[model samples]
Target chain A: MPQTHTFEMGMTCGSCANAARRVLEKMGEGITIDSIDVPTKRIVVTTEKSAEEVKTQLEKTGKAVSGVRITHIESH
Target chain B: LHQGKVSVEGMTCMSCVNHIQDTIGAKEGILNCTVSLQEKTATVIFDGSLWNGESVAEAIDDMGFESKLIS
Candidate 1:
């Protein structure tokens, strides 16, 4: 099964958002970040990693990352 | 010619990009400025004799934009 995680990251501007987006994109295969909303300070990513792992790694960036929610996708 | 790349964080939409670019471009010593939302970066062509990279970054910071020197 695949999953999508939404994270509220600390992105002060577009450059920072771009940096964080790049970091999350490399998480795993078939994983993709849907969008990064700067106004909401959110990084919406859909990945294969466990919800906890995604949150943990996202926090490791050492930024203001929190408010993570995961949605499970059934694999065919 | 001294060029500086100021990587800013938090700009989500074009409005933010416009605000930051407008603010920085208006600063003194900045000869040219290019902003990319995809790259999340602002490249400025300036006269080092007039201003330093720190100053350029500071200008953006003062405008409420999180900025760092990439170059």
Candidate 2:
């Protein structure tokens, strides 16, 4: 199953967005970045892992993460 | 070899420290990169002929963080 997770992160610029991408990329395979909106301070990611697990990984990037929510879940 | 310091703003945690260090240290001619979250600064050592403070500052800036060469 694939799950989509949305997180509220403090991102101010393109560089911040890129940094977030880089951090997620470092999380290795099985995770894909759906989008990062700096103005909205929202990051959407799709992965096989649980939202809680993904949130833990994202927090390692040193950004202030306000919240994480499971937006969608796919059985396939 | 050249050693310099740059002040960085908007770092929230040690992960930011590691990200900055790894990002800058990954560049060619960069010998070492140390980032201090508490000080909001980064110190780098690099080959002067192949790199400079401007390039390092630019790299940091490109990462969405504000950086200024202090030395």
**Candidate of highest lDDT:** 2
- The digit string of per-residue lDDT tens for model 1 on B4-46 reads 9988766678866775676567767788888888898889989
The deviation in Å at residue A57 for candidate 2 is: 2.3
Q: Give the distance in Å from residue A60's predicted Cα in candidate 1 to where it truly belongs.
A: 32
Distance from true location, Cα of B43 in model 2, Å: 1.1
Query: Which regions of candidate 2 fall more than 4 Å away from where they truly are?
Result: A74-76, B1-41, B44-71
**Candidate 1 lDDT for residue A26:** 48
Q: What overall lDDT goes with each candidate model?
A: 0.72, 0.79
Tens-digit per-residue lDDT, A21-72, candidate 1: 5556546466677898879998877766776776665554445668878767
Q: Write the per-residue lDDT of candidate 2 for residues A1-76, one digit (tens) a residue.
A: 7778899987766657777786688678999999999899999999998877776656655567867878666455
Candidate 1 fraction of reference contacts recovered: 0.13
Q: Single out the weakest 10-residue window by summed lDDT for candidate 1 chain A.
A: A55-64
Give the CAPRI rating of model 1: incorrect
Each model's DockQ? 0.09, 0.12
